[model samples]
Target chain A: MVTGPRTLAQVSEGDLLAEIFPYFAAHDGLLIGPGDDAAVIATGGSVVATTDAMVRGRDWVDEWSTAADVATKAFTQNVADVAAMGAVPTSLLVTLVADPQTPVQWAVDFACTLGRLAQESSVAVAGGDLSSAPTGTLMVSVTALGDLGGRRPVLRSGAAPGDTVAVCGTLGRSAAGLALLQQDLGALAEVDGLRAECVAHHLRPVAPVEAGPAAAGAGATSMLDLSDGLLRDGDRIARASGVRIALDSELLRPDTDVLAQVVGGAEALECVLAGGEEHSLLATFAGALPDGWRPLGRVEVGEGVTLDGSPQAPRGWDHFAG
Target chain B: MVTGPRTLAQVSEGDLLAEIFPYFAAHDGLLIGPGDDAAVIATGGSVVATTDAMVRGRDWVDEWSTAADVATKAFTQNVADVAAMGAVPTSLLVTLVADPQTPVQWAVDFACTLGRLAQESSVAVAGGDLSSAPTGTLMVSVTALGDLGGRRPVLRSGAAPGDTVAVCGTLGRSAAGLALLQQDLGALAEVDGLRAECVAHHLRPVAPVEAGPAAAGAGATSMLDLSDGLLRDGDRIARASGVRIALDSELLRPDTDVLAQVVGGAEALECVLAGGEEHSLLATFAGALPDGWRPLGRVEVGEGVTLDGSPQAPRGWDHFAG
Candidate 1:
């Protein structure tokens, strides 16, 4: 009849945990890791904590993404928040809530990918929970904790007038990739160069993990992850700091020019201004721009965001608003 | 037609967050609270971390529980695990994934209850994530972080053959209450005293949060939270410590006898043996039993758990087994 426990329903939670525990290694300076009531890790006086979740249908579909891709996205989304706090991510606690009918292999693949990514980043998979869900439902969430080695947290309220607005990672890539997929599902197999890269970024975008602490060390006035769009996220900084963010089209050309070749001239500008999930670091500096960061705008004495002296509405991803 | 955001989809994520943010107070020694990418909290030299999640259909039914009930249960379940680790819970990161049609009042009620609980326990509500789920789906998860205060974590493997097994909280009340509700959904309002208490416990379980650090201070050799029934969790300690746990039926009468008044004798025994979600602290002590803890059994030179020299099968909640 049955050779092994194939579906999650066929195995006990302990059996599944036993199969997945080996993928995660202990965090640096961890007193305990997994397989216990809880895990323990050394924190440098204070810890930076954040969480993110991805649901099936809402976050991704099986057709465009794999388990590894899901793991990468969840990992980056969480670690990006930690980095945006100007902290070094030290550990993660992941939860997988899925239906009993899900294949056991999917959990294994997700764990393997997450563990490898943690190891590469030197972050620890400390602890997590697993629960069975209703039919046709599978979700994953991550809680990332980071260490701040005595640096003051760079808050969104610190952007003063005359500060330079900058970003350290790609812009509009994930949104453009989503557009490409909407245009053609087979864009990955057909398209090459920037288009393929965009699709890949949409599926599993990379975050400039190290640039966060670098910006903090370089005296960043304000910072945040570009999770929504430039205008929407910029408005957050503007509202918090009580200053306006004035963007120059000439400065965004480095990103828009490249995306134009893949999509179009007009669409590229829209993507660069209103696209989401880029996972890029957006910050403001009072002095010299730090390494790897390019200036895109400036902080002014007004409110909201402006593009070439015109007020633009903030347009991007908002979970419930959509 | 609507005065404010009635349903989640009626408002943006920011507007909803602005409504809920005031419910949480900044934690003691918290450098930064919500309204940022992450929250920063001061910790001891080390931090104890654990996560637990509850799904809508599988973990609860909306007909039987309210949003406040869900928050209380989730809080107790997670803090109980941290208490079991012999640490003081310092902060929590919560995530709520709900369908767009879910009412905003539900979220507000949950935050209110959770914030009150955190304030009572002196734990900070650090930060969290919110995402919209598909139709008819809702879930909540909590990640609790604790401070050890320089004490070594009491591991399950530390039990010796001569140690005394003990528990510091109520037993089988939640399961017995479930039985009452299953027998008659009207048992809660129709019944009073112990029966109503059982039903209330089943709806909102409370753990002996203080006894964990007390047990650790009193030199507990092994410890764990009794979420999944006594027999199954006892077997875990037996397997981990490589010693047999010989439970005393005479000692169990205090629990079974109390539950038998609510349920029948046999059902009470079964409930005491295999009830899940009790949120009690179970431990092994080499010296004298700590205050608030009563002896349940003794560790013996064998494997598995036994009741009065008779082996008992490990039976309890296994998330995917059903």
Candidate 2:
């Protein structure tokens, strides 16, 4: 009971909520905030909604990632999905289901980072639930709501045979970072520059959020965020559109070349082709590429994704497929 | 891979999604459904959003609840929150974080029940996330989004002095059911009629979802769903509205009377007073009681909740208070 350190079990839910609720102040268009049973947000015409959850050991380990890192990843993943729909991120409902033994400080830190990031993005921190979990459990789930701003949602089925495949953010950096981490703890101290950037991207990846609406405005045929991998997510567009995505190795040099310096040639190619959690915007455009986007491939009359005309199976995170 | 009984770890994410996505057929206002980065839904005015998450062991036990029961409770709790905000439930984003070793049948059955319930309620099962969790972890979260239909949100902070307190549904039934479960296994079979109803209500409690908008339409001053229990939740409305909720034990006879026969007098009073998870609509009406609502108390120019002029403290589920 001494205030040296406190577990959630030592505090009331109302007390903890009162402490964190201040971080999520009222934002524009938020009619009601966190006090009520539900939050009221004024939407334009359409709302883009998505949810993403992360488990403690599954998503990130405590040794490598902090509460802020977890919050960043969870928040980014949800809003990136909203952005991929060509919608501006508006609000987030965050659910924290932690073990009673978990420290209150961890939750407070997570809420602080989540609130700060949401505010920086001009997103409202809407209310969510808190519940106790089994011992040793700590998980966070974020449901992000977005405003479409009168744009028709760009679907994966809209890509045509003649469309150009383009991406607006880093490729394989997250995977490369994971590889570094997995390869050795020595990499953490010895790595620098691009290698360090890769590790950072893996822990708290950032997406080209603005480029999503920009691509939509520039007449994107189909779009999605690269949460899985280039091959897997690209194959999603291909399968959905009933067309093949043909990627040129020459076109992918800009990314692979940079990654090769950090993780070597073969691994760099693999990372570029099949890395997960990139959070980049991948879209098919019938016209010229958008400002922040670079051409990656082309949609052809076939099926699935191809690298230099060779088929590539999905090689990324599959929730059930351990 | 002989398909007798399969674990989630045996299947790919897309394969599982493919099998379950059909359950969520498009609704009228759904611009886009699952399979994309985000689901796009059309809204008329303000959107009322609420989220609730349940852990496997904490919220329910495998010995007492099936996957269908969990789905029902999760869906009900979320929609109940949205309805309590004076809005019509429109769509839901469900996140399932489960152990990879969990059976595929559990996920499928959950989705089937969830999709069916959403359809029955005219709610779209828009899109959500599925991720593997640590061993023994199985959690489900639901974020329900609703349309305000041009009506102002009926907040808990709107109750003024001299308002009549009314409730539209059952009280203490869920907690009574929980008590029965925790007390005796013999109660399940030996108790047939009303006692069985209590147990069933605890497993999958139903809400008077329609009464929410109707109360708002009737110009009710304030309202909320009895989630954490009448006493605890009533205190919420009182503290928010800066008024006292004065209860009349005589008027609550209808609920306590029926409960008394099922669980006895002393316990029945406890259940009616502090029982939790009763998804009933409680409101303070400045005018006449609505069609389905029954008067139970009054709003006075004070603070907290009082029973027969005696002060009562908040008692019910507190997630971190284990």
Candidate 3:
């Protein structure tokens, strides 16, 4: 018989599933939910799908991040990919591979946070898989499915010359927060509100999920999530669309100023331009911008991304690069 | 500039993507493919979704399975989940988390084999993610989406008393093969045809993927994939449907006989009853059985599964159970 605080090895798969299933509430879109071989969902004519994974030690360290924090980041990253395609995220399928010795509390915390966030966003936690991994390893993978709602998907290759580039969420807060944490200033959050907020942003990013469909509805020609930094992700649109994205340094001052308060002026500017995992919506529009969107720059007949008149090299997170 | 047979750490993410993207061919169902943040696919009124993952050391050993073998098993497992729901699998999203020092050829081999199989199956390779893992860890997760074609999903809880229980594919070959391999008879294939077939079955098990929807169309009341052995998975249907699955030992003789050629009679019987990873379709029908399906038992008003009027204990693979 299992006693108090039993590890996963001591618990049966059925028992663990019984514990995890209750966290996911049913929704109208889910025709068939968990407990089956596959989940059936009512989808639009076209469905948008993407998968992303986060591994412990590489994507996050247990010393600085909680299970809830990992869950939040994993959820945001995948949903943001669907949002980047100008679609409404409707359902998610999560997969967790963990060592048998992993604490039951960790899985419970992750599921509770993911379910709560998914429900709040009106996205159903349709189904998921659980498997045992090697010792000391824990990884989570999420596949987000979205509905296009009859709108044409906004691709990264749709930007054209003379289009106004805009952004809909915070830029450098996450990166600035990482900087603070690296300096062992996490304890400073109790004394400084701004520092705490930065740390929180870095740990749990909230993507402007609705802004994706909104930008499409407002005639945005091209869009993507600001995941791999502003400069690097922006350059993707520029190269794919065969145009140049020219950003005005003055236009980014507002975002840079917010980071400057914590990380100083030069470092803030760098963070705003080069920080990854922001999960913000970056898009280009030929017409008027959507509400809550701030203009950043414009598309020009050139190549790559530029700041003012100078071309900038693409630099951001690369999983394989040394 | 990266050259030669370099490790993943020696190549940039962009170079790796560029190398892998060409392997995936575009399909009409895939409106948006891998180049974008998310893939867009055409679906029926309802879509079936499921996710499954396999870890390196836990699920496979490098000496026993090649990268291509792993890819095939991963693809089959996810697609089998969709098939179990009586849906036509249409698209897949894959994710790989590996150490940076992993050989580039492993990734290339996996992608090439997966793309080839997906094309042959008429399933589109939609989109995927790649991330770095801790040292000595490798994992792959796949999310398969299927079209229901306007049919009601055949759920696990729909079987009633007097239903005919049947199976649509091979049963104990996979487990028999694993036994032969475990006994170091994998290299004895040249001397014995049956041993070779068993080895092949264990290495790459294939499911009758198209038979699922056909069974549903023929009035199957309940259906699921035989992934975790016959007795254990049969018990699941029995518990979920609140009926007893009574198997006739005489009806299972053919499958047992086939396995008996490689292994002894008693061992073959054990494999037929308790072997896992078969990926075959098991269902109960209230009407005429579909083609390629053979009768195995009957659903009776009771609890759990039985064989020859005797209660059988549920035993199969449990990822977390000690």
Model 3 chain A poorest ten-residue lDDT run: A1-10
Give the count of colliding residue pairs in each prediction.
0, 0, 0
- The model with the greatest DockQ is 2
Worst 10 residues of 2 chain A by lDDT: A185-194
**lDDT to native, each model:** 0.91, 0.91, 0.91
Tens-digit per-residue lDDT, A185-296, candidate 2: 4256344777788988999988888888888889999999999899989989998999999999999999999999888999999999899999999999999997989999
- Tell me the spans in candidate 3 whose CA falls farther than 4 Å from its real position: A1-4, B1-4
Under the 3 Å rule for N, CA and C atoms, how many clashes does model 1 have?
A: 0
True contacts kept of each: 0.84, 0.91, 0.91
DockQ of each: 0.85, 0.89, 0.88
CAPRI-wise, candidate 1 is: high
Q: How accurate is chain B of model 3, given as a TM-score from 0 to 1?
A: 0.97
> Could you report the Cα RMSD, in angstroms, for every candidate shown?
1.6, 1.4, 1.5
Better structure of 2 and 3 per DockQ: 2
State the iRMSD of every prediction, in order shown.
0.9, 0.8, 0.8
- C-alpha lDDT of residue A84 in model 3: 89
Per-model TM-score versus the true fold: 0.98, 0.98, 0.98
